[model samples]
Target: MLTKDGCKQLRDFTEKNYKETISEVAEGVWFVLGAGHSNAVFVETDFGIILIDTLDTLERGEKLLGIIRQNTGKEVKTIIYTHGHPDHRGGAGAFLESRPEIIAFEPKCAELEKADLLQDIQKLRGTRQFGYSLTDEEAVSQGIGVREGITHGERRAFVSPTTVYRQDTVTREIDGIQVEMVRLPGEAEDQIMIWFPQKEVLCCGDNYYGCFPNLYAIRGGQYRDIAQWIDSLDKIMSYPASCLLSGHTAAVLGHEEIKRTLGNFRNAFEYILIHALEGMNAGKSAEQLASELSLPPEYAELPYLVEHYGCVEWTIRAIYTAYLGWFDGNPTNLHPLSPGIHSKKMTALAGGAQNVWKTARKAMEEKEYQWCLELCDLLLSNDETACGEALLLKARALERIAEYETSANGRHYYLEYARELREKNKKG
Candidate 1:
């Protein structure tokens, strides 16, 4: 959730840059660009049209189907999934009129069911990251740079695949289109890349997208294999792809352009992984690694490498945690006191809640928002009566910080915290 001003800034940015439209990437291939924070690609074949991932919800899926009908009017003979992400597969049932043959890499029905068990917590965190729970006035866009479509009732649109490829790589001749799908696990466990030998078109799922990919979602999940992800990118780079269509954003045209883009994308992640590991091997803390690691000017300057969704520091932390567990080699944290207990002691040492609150207000006035938040935390630790003023100060501080953030995820997290504070105040 964003404050009014913050939301306005986001909306303005989105209006200028995030508008989606349909386009023909190749002779017979059409892209339903940015339909629902994701894109669906339809490939015309001799047998019929081969539909790629189905966007987000049923409504968006239906809208895409309408576009397909208007353009090719070819009945869907085959449906292929790039991954198991909701945005990519949630709208599967929307185009059931043709009863297309569905395909995906090694069916994850059981795994998906297990993942669904944690949906309660996942959805909560997802709402914060996506501003899904934001009020209309306070809501804006997501990391994909589009306003997420609201879904109603049950997600009855997602349909399971009829055909599952158990091998690492499989080739099929679907409707005269020589389709090659390789299991390149990276962004998601069930991720795959589809290559059209005849057309030389490569359909990369969320693995290769416009913005810096989410190596580690703030909404917690199993560790994404960074090394495996890098290897997967290398595999895609091997292809002589004239046209590159991704899960989100528009298609990248020309072979040279696709190569350059994918090369830089791979290097960006490799750069982060190398430097972070180097710092880690040197016994540096995650905080220190995050602060010290910096992308070279060449890699940092790319439009697609913008930290709009994934932050390098967050990736560093994820790498650290994945390899070394939660213990950051800090003895003080080995058996730490509860945050509330520690905060209570600290507030007493700072004189009293009144003195701390005064300092917090002064910090806010000086635009030292980080300091203000720290001071407010101390005050609210011991005194429940101080919560209202402290929360207000914290919310304001967070909102101000969110305004300057380039990463939408960073902005959303800050704004979400502010929303939490405001809601708490309202309850009181």
Candidate 2:
């Protein structure tokens, strides 16, 4: 259950920075297409425009193409995917049907087609572990469009690249400019940086994007190799590019600005690595390091290195876990109770959901946000739609914690829920 105060705080905080972000960083040569964390690149190739990232889907891609056509009135000559992340390749079908050439990193070609999560659409879509928390029926009914996230491998059959680059250093001449593709590992495994030597523009697929990276895969998949991510970023630092682009977010312009931004990003990742290594040497548990580690001043001061999607402390835990298995050497946590089972027992011990709700209120009053969230999660998980009062309280509680959150993703999720809850009750 959520407290009243938490709701008010969340609403106010959300309104504050909901739209205060760069939608497009348009330089004279290249225009940033995606707002916040969604964007594709269009380079002015001699024959026409060479696009990097096709957008999320055919419809979204067509709309983005309309935007491009409005400026240049030229066809997309080719499509170069940064990686296999759905956001980057979703629009490829739209482009490939029209464009003459399609290219992608070879590793990504294999990754996108892999059968584990992709083949099992039900498990990927409905299961909480990997996919979004949505049933296939609900997802389709909502007109949420292609089940691409769940149907990654199925969609892969539609997107096999004719041209694949297997080497670390691959260069191709398109129209007039020379494009360089360097393999890397970050954000996604099949990653690359597209560099234009003469134009001095570098499209950093997902690497070196502002903010701390989710070093470990959070939505549950393969844990990202942080060591490889670091090595990839360090190599990109060697480039002398005037213009820098991100898969999402604003672009960094000018050679100096790009250098400074890349340096900060590099330092942040390195810092996380060092701290995680040190904690491991000291035999620090993942839970302890997660709570204890703080973003030091040097990396914290950089505006681009904000806690948008990833936090330094959490990244350290991720890296630690990536190296050292999950056991943490603690016998107690070695075999812990599962979430559903644990929550049921906890509710019983606390005198049922109603008492848990009352205790939640006390926790909120005492500013014990973590405790309040934990208890409220149990209540909501057990009976949210039926337990109207508890559901309302849970919304309020999440809203309160949203106020203290600086990350854009965290804030949006809380207030969005609160808004949804308000509408649900209003209709009821």
Candidate 3:
């Protein structure tokens, strides 16, 4: 649970950064923001409208359709998915009444099929990642941009893609609008960017959002190729897009601003990649590299590069894991004791479980929350039934850490765990 001040801080951040609005980015291109966890853009042509990336759920999609109706009575002729992410295409059924031709990248269709196999676990992890368990007062924005509508309703009216393209770039003239769908996977393996040469507008799927790119989602997914993602960013910069619309955040209007923003975003990723590889070559473990790495002041100050969504430390660890699988070349780790046994030994070494709890309390008093958490973990793991106070201490430390956490995802995880601890303490 969030304290009053902590809740206020989150709410203020959301109010300042994620206000809902719609902007006519180009002549007939309108970018819709805050309708859902993700954004959507509809391009009107002589024949009809081309909708890119439907917002999250069916209700939100209906709302977006209403917004489209307000501007032009032209029905949605075609729906193009930027990627296979549920948020990008979940609301397709809302537009089924119009019988729009649904289109997706070939690989994306396969990705969706694979996702269906693990849908249950994926949904569970996704809910925790998005902080769906947080109360209304405790919840803030999704940390990408949107503040509401993600968990509004679970009715996802997903429609399968009718058309799939396998080419690197597919050119199509929908109605009178000439568009190019360029394959540039970044956040998602099957991600693509829709480029309008005539309008000089580019709808970059999840490639470029407001915050630092989620190089690795904690919710769990396949390893994101950092090199491939950087290459994709370069591909996006190759185009001279006067107006840039992304999957989550606000649209960038001018070409110069778009160039500078994309350049810096790409550089930030490159900086992390280069440094992590260097550290690995020097025989530093991923943990050591993560602790030492920090973005330069130039890249750090950029509003878009903030760790509101993805932390740099997590990215560093992800890079290490991507290049070299789980083992950090430490033989001891190959056959380490189980966490339960390890914690019991640590508790015994600290004199007793009560002694560990006392040390944790002292660490908390010294504002060493991380160390306190480790101590509390040892105590609880050794004997959870006998160490009820350790649970409360851990919950307090988590709340204190979450109070100042910059990353919304990190904060949510801390607070949610804290809530669980308190509930467990009550039951104990």
Residues 308-397, model 2: lDDT tens digits: 445566576677767897778878887889766777787888787778878888998987876876777887666431366656776787
Across 238-317, the per-residue lDDT of candidate 1 in tens digits comes to 99999988887668889899989988999999999988888888888898888878788898768787666777778889
The positional error of residue 43 in candidate 3, measured at the CA in angstroms, is 0.7
What tens-digit string does per-residue lDDT give for candidate 3 at 1-428?
12335445555666776667888888999999877888999999998899998888888889889999999888999999999888888778789888999988866323434567887877666666677888655657668866445455456778999998888899989998999999997898789999999999999999997877678887777778778888998998889899999998888888899989999999999999999999999888999998889899999888788777778888888888888878898898999998788987877887877777678888999988889998877777764424677788899998887876677777777877788789998897
Models ranked on lDDT: 3, 1, 2
Better of 1 and 3 by lDDT: 3
Model 1 Cα shift for residue 60 (angstroms):
1.2
What would the TM-scores of all predictions be?
Answer: 0.91, 0.74, 0.92
Q: What 10-residue stretch in candidate 3 is worst by lDDT? A: 1-10
Q: After superposition, how far is residue 93 of candidate 3 from its true place, in Å?
A: 1.9
The residue ranges of model 1 lying beyond 4 angstroms of the native Cα positions read: 1-13, 107-118, 135-137, 151-156, 383-386
Regions of model 3 farther than 4 Å from truth: 1-11, 108-122, 147-150, 384-386, 425-428
In candidate 2, residue 377 scores what lDDT? 81
Quick one: best lDDT, which candidate? Answer: 3
